[model samples]
Target: MFMTLTADSGADRAETWVERRRPALHPRRSWASPEPFVRRPTEHNSGEDVLGAMPWTRSASGYQRITVAIDVVVALAVVVAAAALGGAGWLTAGLLGLLATGTHVSFVAALRGYERHNLGDGPAEFQVVLRSAVVVAAVLMAVAFLTPVQVPREAVLVGLPALVTLACAGRYVHRRVLHASRARGQAMMRTIVVGSTVSVRDLVRDLGTAPHHGYLVIGTCLADVVDDEAAQVPLPTLGALSDIPQVVHDHAVQVVVVAGDALGGPALRRLSWALRRAGAELVVAPGLVEVAQERVTVHPTAGLSLLRLEIEPPRRRLMAKAVLDRVLGLVALVLLSPVIAAGALAVRLTSPGPAFYTQTRVGVDGREFRIWKLRSMYVDADRRRAELLDRSDRDGLMFKMAADPRITPVGRVLRRLSFDELPQFWNVVRGDMSLVGPRPPLREEVSAYHDAVHQRLNVKPGITGLWQVSGRSDLPWDESIRLDLRYVDNWSVTMDLMILWKTFRAVVGGAGAY
Candidate 1:
């Protein structure tokens, strides 16, 4: 059969193509077919108004404007304060402040820190801000030695750190606000996924899991090989891959995610050109799921760009982590001793058992450690576990019951506040655990693990890690293990610090504690 490609909208009228095809076992859906495709309702197609409705919408350049304003204010306030406090002449201090602020902002801009696309998500934003700060510091040091002007020591010592801290804090606060907006479905980018049926479905599922990332999947376009499985995807079938351009235009899509090899080199390039004219961003997924940006670098060779994966040696950072864990763990243990004591006292008074609970948990290298916690359940809690197995709220190896009968009234409060885990700091100090690592698994849990899951045993389990910060008991068994394994394979000291910061927030919110 001969098929003449056509455009539905006047804007796409000038660009049209044709294809000759033979009927296959599974006939492809036509855009002009009287049957309605799986497109979203008219309300979902109102995403074109999402950014214009709000002054600070993430998809607009307003986010970048806010970021740059924050950076300028922070840099100026810190430098000017330092210069004035150091007793510099008014003119000198003013000039110095301007120079420093300009240099700092320029460095950040040079690093693409203020780009709207990089503003709301990922560590790249913070990483670039940090890099800019480091470069500014080195430049200031050069100015101090190589020039006649004497840069104030206080500015170097105080201003740089203050600038970075305040800038990063601003970014964090802005991100939180953006996330809140996205959760309410306010600032999301209208997204269309294009690939094979299974690939499109998988991408949709993963994207749905983290709505805060802001790509709202409105529908999907199947590749040339349409199959029965296409019906299983939750997203509506916009059309076949060849119809992506028209689909993007009709839906007013902001982002087009190309998954798998639905479009080969020339076709993908052509799609990019089409998307550019439609003012939509084209994101090609290389199918490397959950890989950290730090591990991947792009190398352009012979007119093609290849991704080079670099694995940092674990041993290089292990010693630093060990030292940090012991120092911070001991300090935290000392500072929080009174709170732990109060929790233990509460547990003891309310339950007919010791205040502390100890259990043997498999740790790094499959070695066992006596994990400690403030007992939040009755003495017979362990004995009653088998009886409650059928009623467990969670699935897979991990067992969690939202309303377990074994939990004491006091235990519920402790668990809610996460004070029950305070005794684990002592374990951290004792070198049995790190400040951040995989969740320590039960011996029974370890025994049931598959080979891939065993990778979690490579590092010492933590008092608080990705699993703890990311929904805790609310996460399913498979999800929890996936997070732990991701941490084991791609953790840095920076990631540990980020996890610790998030732990504080999670504990305070107490959303998924049960």
Candidate 2:
């Protein structure tokens, strides 16, 4: 129960003694349960001797090499393809093409596109791609006007856009591959969690919560308290903070994460030095959780790293979102008119109800609006809802049966493909909804909502959002709320587009369709 840390093998002997006493504390090398301190590799990174050596930096190195190869290939292909299409001489075409390609690569590099991405930080890379494209376009246009080089007009207009698309597509392919690799238990950092017992447990739970995040909690080195109760809490304590260097070397740790009041700057500096020798990077997980990276800007003032938080004005964002919703909504309505019509007819004939179902749902600011959908159930389906409440198998505030008898045969198919929701394009056009926002809450659902849930009302209800792309009816209520609230706080045009892109996949897969 008690151990003293000496300069040498003393710490190793103690850990061995502890592990022998509590074999359960020593998790098997394979992936284990979702609890903290499981010795199992997937208990957050599998295999200590083998997989612990599989650091993220190595995978990142390989990923970067592939990225470079993709960039070069895309750049060359775009230039050659554009030159063949554009009416320009070889010398002029080559010069302009190379210039555009070089400039974009440089811009992207400066924007940190090549940097390692955090897990769950969805699609932030695409924004960097767009910005780099804009800069390349502006520079090329300026050069054409200022000089007598005679740049090709068609090439500048069309080729530049094509180049951007190709580069982004290549990045997307690489990103997907990288994610897959991480999911398969490759590409993760061998992490040593250093903090108070509570902080280490919390961090383990948080880090372990998202397995694909690639932070493999191989071991722990606790802070402050010296009772060494870390093992009792069950994280494999590699002794005290003083034994960090030994632990890092022993486990081949690639990352050493400091949580809570673990070490002061001087102690951290010393720790960093020791970790550097072991080739491990140090990370500090501040207590502030779930802050969007976009909102936080780092400012160094008098040697202090200050986090400047930018507060977005609710009124301005909502106004801009309203405009986008109507414009896109009108376009969708026109495009999907035939599908909507067919869905309505199918519902009417099969369900013996009005073709269109319009129910009052709470929108932004608790305003009630008639949300439209093609009927997906019999005429008395809503009335029979009370009878099914006793037999509900649902998550949180949601009530959905995997196989509901109220659903008509046609309704089942409509719901499966989400064809019945097409009428909501009109709601989007009328400003009753948004292309991307929170779910339109039912009147009873809103009444049951707590104070924090009202933040969803700050923005208009969305048609396809984080909730839609995520498992719809199948997702737990808490997780659904978290995703919706995350969107509400961090909504952007790019985020909306990302959600829309993901929505297509979710719909096609029918992942959570009832």
Candidate 3:
């Protein structure tokens, strides 16, 4: 028995996975259960199977290695460019460039910048490069001040930013390649989960949902759960705790993620020993969900381990973000005045309504603000909304329609390319919205929100957001909410900038645009 992992059936497998959505990875079948299978050295060659490079795709490890190479090359290029700009002698610059490169490589290694967990991770890569470059800059400044050898002011001023930018760009490209490869079922570790069925279910759902994390769950080692033998999970059950090593070797598993404590410390230790012998990596899940590694610090003391988590990002960063939003919004409104004017004109001429549409939307902390958009529908579109509710094909509290009868001819084009939302730049200027944040919900939607969902109200709503760029009207309601919640949890200036950059691509593509 074999089945595919689908997002819609994001629950306990049993019989549901077979009947629900049918898409993911390649169409190839994987074992649905373990049989009287034997392990032979010639039967399983990981290097020949998983690590073999197809003409179009490389292995995940190979991708990581290539990314490492790209980073060093970027560092060298940045150094050379900086030296050329600083008018330094070739020999002198070459020596300094090599030194800088060495420093960069050393810092990245210490930071685990090229680790599998960090590979294709844009924000992590960017943060590491920036912090490392800052340290490098400071070291140079201190050396110049103390010693007779003075570093070039031009290099310090230009090189740091250049190195950070180039390094981040390389990481972005690496992530892009990895994501594309993963979608095609390449560049992912053949992974297995070890835990109770319920605990493993959550982990599997999470990994399936975010396949870019690069773990492809092939089978699971489900520990004994009382009375759960009457239940069956969608995942292939390899065996109990005793059969782990054989299961790992037989399946050519590269990674084993231990979720919860179905296997206690001593048992887990023994399992780790088995995995080590099998040449597989082990990840013990802390059971903390959605926490960024940046917020975590692990320390070992007195034969014990402690994990510390910071509650939130610094207040100074949030303050700076507010300042940036207002400044950028003001500048954007001014720059996009002509485009706004043209869109308004189109709306006014094509529809029998005012060029602007305003609606009361809930913002940060349950506060309400009137959101503005270039009216893309008839004036009475709101009046006809109730009748169209039954036709909605989306999940959650959101409503959408691709063939919505209310939209005017001109409004259709504007909505698709997202030009209609340009007036919200003014909302961003008014501080009622932001350049990047959660999507503003209607009063009714906010009223229906669960307590946990209210976290979306922690920051001001946005003109564009994770929800908008994700799929706009076409996204399923739950995924939209997930993306928004994710934004609320992981908002950072760099993350915001990355979203904004992808926003351009999304708008142009009009993937889920209504």
Give the winner by lDDT: 1
Q: Candidate 3 residues 233-343, lDDT tens each?
A: 667776654456666766777888888766544345445656666657788886887676666787765544567777787998788888989998999899999999999
* Residue runs of model 1 more than 4 Å from their true location after superposition: 1-59, 225-230, 301-304, 310-314, 344-355, 408-410
Model 1 lDDT per residue over 292-411, tens place: 877787876665567888665457687889988999999999999999999989887776889999999999999998999999999998989999999999999888999989989999
Q: How many angstroms is residue 117 displaced in model 3 relative to the true structure, after the best TM-score fit?
A: 2.9
Ranked candidates, highest TM-score first: 2, 1, 3
* Model 3 ranges with Cα > 4 A deviation: 1-42, 45-61, 139-152, 225-231, 299-313
As a whole number from 0 to 100, the lDDT of residue 461 in candidate 1 is 94
Candidate 2 TM-score to native: 0.84
Query: Number of the top candidate by TM-score?
Result: 2
- The clash number for model 1 is 0
lDDT rank order: 1, 3, 2
**Error in Å for residue 203 of model 3:** 2.3
Could you tell me every candidate's TM-score relative to the true structure? 0.83, 0.84, 0.82
Give the per-residue lDDT digits (tens) of candidate 2, residues 78-108. 6656755777677877787777778777877
